[model samples]
Target chain A: MSTMTMAKALNAGLRRALDANPKVLLFGEDIGKLGGVFRITEGLQKDFGEERVIDAPLAESGIIGTSFGMAMRGYRPVIEIQFDGFVYPGFDQIVSQVAKFHNRTNGRSSVPMVVRIPYGGGIGAIEHHSESPEAYFVHTAGLKVVTCSNPNDAYWMIQQAVASDDPVIFLEPKRRYHDKGEVVHESKPIALHQARIVRGGTDATLIAYGPMVKTCVEAATIAEEEGRSLEVIDLRSLSPIDMVTLTHSVRRTRRAVVVHEDVRTLGVGAEVAARLGEELFYLMESPVLRVTGHDLPYPNSRVESDFLPDVDRILDAVDRSLAY
Target chain B: MSQPLQPWGGPPGATPHADAMTASDEMVQLLTPEGRRVEHPDFAFTGDDAEIAGLLREMVLARRLDLEGTSLQRQGELGLWPPLLGQEAAQIGSGRAVRDADMVFPTYREHGVAMLRGVPVGDMLALFRGTSMGDWDIDEHRFGQYQIIIGAQTLHATGYAMALQRDGLIGNPEPDRNAAVLVYHGDGASSQGDVNESYVFAASFQAPVVFFCMNNQWAISEPSTRQSRIPLYQRAWGYGFPGVRVDGNDVLAVKAVTDWAMERARQGQGPAFIEAFTYRMGAHTTSDDPTKYRLSEETEAWRRKDPIERVKTYLLDAGAIDDGWLSDLDAEADALGEHIRSTCRQLDSESLAHRFDVLFREPTAESEDDRDAHLSYLARFEPLSEESAR
Candidate 1:
């Protein structure tokens, strides 16, 4: 076991992927010698030559479209969209070609590529930087969306996404990039798309993914001091969704709350709420409440903490659900 | 009044065409509009009578398919069709220059190129007919699937060419073995950022690809003049690659220019660009009306310079084909058009209900549930009444 940050774990995982496949290519802006803005791809270009670790032009669509072509020629390419908002420039290539290639060719061709985006807010950034753009990718039919909260999950999930035959939108939590944790490489890695139960409790269930997993875990810990039990479930896979684990937890607690930093309307939380309503109709003691960001755009960093859900807001929602 | 700006590479006394192109900077030509054989400084067409006749046959068939596709849309057999009427030479010339080993990335309007790449006429119509968005086996044809977004395929072609070069295929000793990529787009699509970025990557990586832009003068209602300040081909010179402008109405000229560019790319000379100066003779698609934006005089001028008329004229003037051979080609085009009409009309929609089945290699639980829910909801509807069936 080694102690590392999420950024370091992700870099290690990317290096392993490059080593495993000779045809794999990594392309990103400022990712070669600069090693990405967060240093997530540091030392990779040195280890792997510039030919394998390419420093692409300042065009996102070119990176993805060319990656799509390379994938057609039997090369697996991992692309990095500098930030969450930056991915919009490449959205056409992603939704139109990268996401649709396998379905467009009826399984005859596979685009085994990873589009890594550092998402979510907390770094006191400018507009277009601290955006949660997961819903756009999750709504896309052909793409498999996933995110990791800790270093261990980051290491395994990065490798798993690169290894999968499907094109994966691998979202990294920018705020949690520096959070340190243990990564036991020898331990059995979890499935890329399965949700994991972070904490076991019976009073109520807390559902979250990516950065919110840590918030939900914190909420559960604080709630225990007040004689309340909350089960925290980390939904690693947002698209396929671990319905089995979700139903098990919700059915046991009979009350639930979903948390995320994205907007409440049409966000990942809304989808989870709908699924809970469909699967656990009469079993629920109260409606599934959501502790999430406001429907408005992510506010400026000055008021972002207020706009984003925190431990207090989650506990407040949990209290309301228990009251119902 | 200020003097005209000389073309970037033309000589001092050369008269420029449309901001920058001289007579010396003019494209390669074999069969002129006057049915005369001409020579070009960069390329030549040395094909014999049999090869010329074959090329003529392809042009005839492609024109027939294009006309029939528009006819199908007018007859309500298709939702839409983008007619490739006046750009036959631009497509066939570039399409034929490609070897089977090379890859092609085509825009949605490259019906002629798709036909030459061995994709069936029926499959080409699938997208407009509302059946599929092109599910052809790309490996078998060495062609990228049809891309609807304008100019996006150029990036794919550049990347594919880069991979081909990296694999030691370019400049290989094996005869007809080296591969290159040819990407097709229209003048309107040239304004897209992806297209310009493609040039950067192709130049930086020295990818073996040809950027074939059919400058058909109109991007729907917008003219090519509105899209660029200089001639379309002259823009590539800024991107550090060789670029040329060809007479799109001259089939022999287009073929020669494209052939030279492909050969250059295969020889590890990096990427090349060809801007085919042509006109969009028909409406952009079934939904558009060219009369709203274009003038009859402009269309008439291009009609007088029709690519097919010049080829047919040259063939007959040279006694390369007889009256009987011309009649045979007409009959064959008629037969092929009839088959296309019949096949499109008889397209069955029963299989469309299962389109979600092939959406993924293994259907996710959410998608599977979505499919099941939709199918069951469809079961609630009553069968069509006799009067409403039509």
Candidate 2:
């Protein structure tokens, strides 16, 4: 097991995918020489050559639209949207073409491609840079949405998403790129669509994904000092939700709090809360609560920390759930 | 071959027909609207009598199928139908130009092309009849599903061309080893962002793709003039590729032009564009009304350049087919029409479970649970008698 940052882990994972398949191609703006804005694909162009690691023109729709054609022609293309906000230009291709290729062709052709988007807020960056656009993709059927919080998952999930036959919207937590964690390359650690229980507790269940997973885990740690047991579950896959693992945790804890960096209305948290309510209606001690960003637009970076859900906000939600 | 560029924005050039009938030097023609054999400096109709007769048969059968589709829609058998009425030559000529190894990405109205690619007439109508969303085996037929979105298939064709290049299927020494991609769209689709981006990508990558745009004078209610300030083929020049306009009603010209473009792509000469200048004699679809927008005089002018009649006229004058052969083809068209009408009626809508089954290659836990839940929900009610259900 080697300790590395999420960015390095992702780079290593992408390199592994390229090495595993000759048909695997990496295409994006500035991904070739500049190695992406975050340097997540650094040294990949040099190692894989310009053919495999291609620097595409500054057109997101063209990148995805062509990638769909290549996928139809039996090539697995891994595309990178420079930022979460920039993905909108290619939104039509993603929602219309990539998402529907498999179903549209009646299972004859499936686009085994991956769209990598660096998402979420808290780095105090510019507008459109720090945004959580996972809900839009998660809401889209035929698309599998997943995000990684730590380095280990970043490594394994990147490879897994590429290996998946279905198109995957792979969200990377830009804020957590510097966070280091041990990645065991020999082991998979977990399934691509399953959620993992980061902390075991009995007082309340804290459900989160991507950047919020770290905040929820931290909340559990702080709650432990105050004689409160809060379980933290990392919802690795947003589309599938991994309800089996979530239901088990909620049934045992009897109280739940969902956390996300996305807006409170019609967000990933709402889907989790609704499902938990329907499935675990009799088992809950209190109504499911959410500790998430406000419905307003992602505020300026100066006050983003206030807008973002932190350890204090998560603990507050847990306290409210325990009180019920 | 090289005629003076027809001055744009002129007083209709004294021709009652729209833009394509101006007899410009830029446009290539093998056979004129008067059924007179014309020679082009660059391209010629190299096919013999048998090939010409075969192309004429295909155009006739396609026209018959299109009329049957319109009749069915009028009879409430179909939700809608996009008739390929006047664009028969453009479709058959370009569709036949595509070799067996090549791939084709067609817009929704390419029923004639779809039939030529070996897809049944009934299968194409199934999309309009609401029984299927095009479940044909793409790899087998080398044809993509009928793309309903305007010009999105251009990008797909470009990408597929790039894939062909990567697969070592282009610029091959052996003839059969080489492959290219053909994408069909219309004049209205030429203005789309995706189509323009496709040109950029295809040029930058030197992808082997032939962009066949049938400039049928109208995009529903809007005229082609609204879509472009110049000839549609000229758009390819700005993208660093060869572009040519052809007399769309002349089947010989379309076939020759498409053949030249496809061969260029197969030789890895980069992407090219061909504007099949024709007219949409019918409405864009059963839903549209051309009378609200276009002039009767313009439609009447184009009627003289009917794609089918010109071919029949040329073949009969050339002594390639007699009255007996024409009657036999009419009987064959009748049989095909009956087959399409019966098959469209028999096309069944697949079950919900089947839809869920095809959504993902590997079934997810959520989809499985949802399918099971739906099944149990239906199972709650007692099964009605099959006779009553029917």
Candidate 3:
């Protein structure tokens, strides 16, 4: 086991996937020489050669559209979206072609490609870069949406995603890119779609994913100090959510609070809340609550901290759930 | 015959040169409208009598299938049919140009190309018949699903070409070893952003692909002029590739140009574009009405240049086929039409549960639970009671 940042772990993971399979290719804008804007694919172009590590044109639609083709050609293409908001240009190809290729052909063919996007906001950045677009993709069927919150998961999940035959929308927590953690390169802690319980407690269940996983863990620590025990569950996969794990935790705790960086209404938190309410309705002691970003466009960087759901907002929701 | 739509800012008829139908000076025509062979400075008509007869047979059979499809739609057997009525030469000539190893990415209307790729006529009609999305195996036939979204397949074709490049399939001296990609779209699709971006990616990567645009003169209610101010083929020059416009009704010329383009790609000459200057003599699909937009006079003019008629005329004038052979070919077409009619009705209507089966390689818990719930709900309806059934 070695200690590394999430970004380095992701780089290592990409290198490992390239080494393991010759058919695996990396396609994106500025990912080659520049090593991606976040440096997640740094040094891969030199190691894997330009043929595998392709620097595509600035057009996002072209990047995704062609990647779908390469996938059809039997190549496992891993595409990188430069930013969360820039993915809109390629949205049509993703929803129309990539999402439907398998069902459209009646299971005869599939585009076994991975589209990686560093999402969520914490550090001060301009508009479009800091938006959370997971809800849009999670609403789409035939796409497996996942996010890694730490170095350990960043290393293992990237490999697991590349190994899967279905298309994965791998969302990386941009705020956690530089966060260091012990990563065992030998094996993954959990499967790609399973949820991980970070901090186990019995009072109230805190459901979070992506960047908010780290925040939930922090909130759990603070709640412990205030004589409240919070069970923090990191939801690895957003689309095919591990409802079994969630139902088990919420069933025991009897209360739940869902959190995320995306907006309040119609967010992933809404789905989690609704599912928890459905599964644990008779068993639960209180109603499922949500502590999420406000239902507004990502505000200016100066006010982003105020707009985002921090530990205090999470604790307040936890307090409310406990009050009920 | 199409009256020139006034150029973007210019007066009407001022850009008559832009009219694809009348702009014949730049087109490569090996077979004239009168069934006479003409000498071209660039392309050569190298087919012998047997090869020419083979082209005629395929074109006749393809047209027969198309006519059957139209009749079926009218007879309420099909939901819709996109007729390739006047573009037979463009479809047949280009469809026969590439080897079986080369991949084809066709728009929804390329039924002729699909037939050449070995996709059964019934399987192609299944999409229209609402029996299934498409049941044919794309990889087995080296053809992609018939993309309904306009021009989206171009990007897939370009990317597949790039894959060929990475696999070292291009620039092979051995002719049989090298392979490329052939993508077909219409003039209306030329205005799509994805189509232009495909050119950028193909040129940038030097991907082996041939962009075959069948300029069918009309895009539903809009004329070809609505899609382009300049000729559609000339757009390739801006992206640093060679583009050629051929007389789409001339089978010999379309085949020759597509062969050259595919050869250039296989030889690592990057991408090439071929604009088959043709006409869509029928409505865009069964639901459309040509009388709502285009004039019959224009349709009459294109009728004189009928692709199949010209090929049949050429064969007769050259003594390549006799009346007996024509009757035999007609009988073959009749048999094929009958086969399609029978097979289309026999297509299995898949169960809704089949959707959960194919939605993912491995079903997630959510999908599984949903499927179970759906099945249980369906099971709640008791099997028809004996008395009720009677």
CAPRI band of model 2? medium
Candidate 3 lDDT (Cα, 0 to 1): 0.89
B1-390: candidate 2 lDDT, tens digit per residue:
545433532233332223232223378888888778988778899999799899999999999999999999999999999999999999999999999999999999998999889987667877898887887878888999898888988988998999999898888789789999999999999889999999999989989999999899999988899998777776676677778899999899999989988988999888888999999999999999999998999999999999889888888999989999999999999999999889888888887777787788878989888888888887766465554787
How well is each residue in B1-390 modelled by candidate 3, as lDDT tens digits?
756544322345454323232333378999888888889877887888789789889989889889988999998999999999888899999999989889999998888889999998778999999989976899889988888889999999999999999889999989888999999999999999999999999989989999999999998898999998888876776676778889999999999989989988998988988999999988899999999898899999999998888778888988889999999999999999999999878876688888887887766878888888999988866564544787
Give lDDT: candidate 1, residue A68: 85
Q: Tell me the spans in candidate 2 whose CA falls farther than 4 Å from its real position.
A: B1-25, B383-390
Candidate 2, A154-235: lDDT as tens digits: 9999999999999999999999999999999786468999999998999899999999998888889999999999889999
- Give a tens-digit lDDT track for model 1, residues B1-390: 656656565335643444222223566567777777787656788787677777888888889999999999999999999999998888888899999999999988888889899987777787789876777778898878888888889988988997897678898777487989999988988899999989999989889999999899999999998998878787776687878889987888888888888988998888888999988899999899999998999999999988888888888988999889999999999999999998897775535446576666556777777788888877666464544776
Q: List runs of model 1 lying over 4 Å from the truth.
A: B1-6, B9-24, B350-353, B379-390
User: Sorted by DockQ, highest first, which candidate order results?
Assistant: 2, 3, 1
Tell me the deviation in Å of residue A309 in model 3.
0.6
| Model 1 chain B lowest lDDT segment of ten | B15-24
Prediction 3 TM-score vs. true: 0.96
DockQ of each: 0.68, 0.80, 0.80
Show what share of the native A-B interface contacts model 1 retains. 0.66
| Global lDDT of model 1 | 0.88
Q: Which stretches of candidate 3 lie over 4 Å from their true place?
A: B1-25, B384-387
TM-score of chain A of each: 0.99, 0.99, 0.99
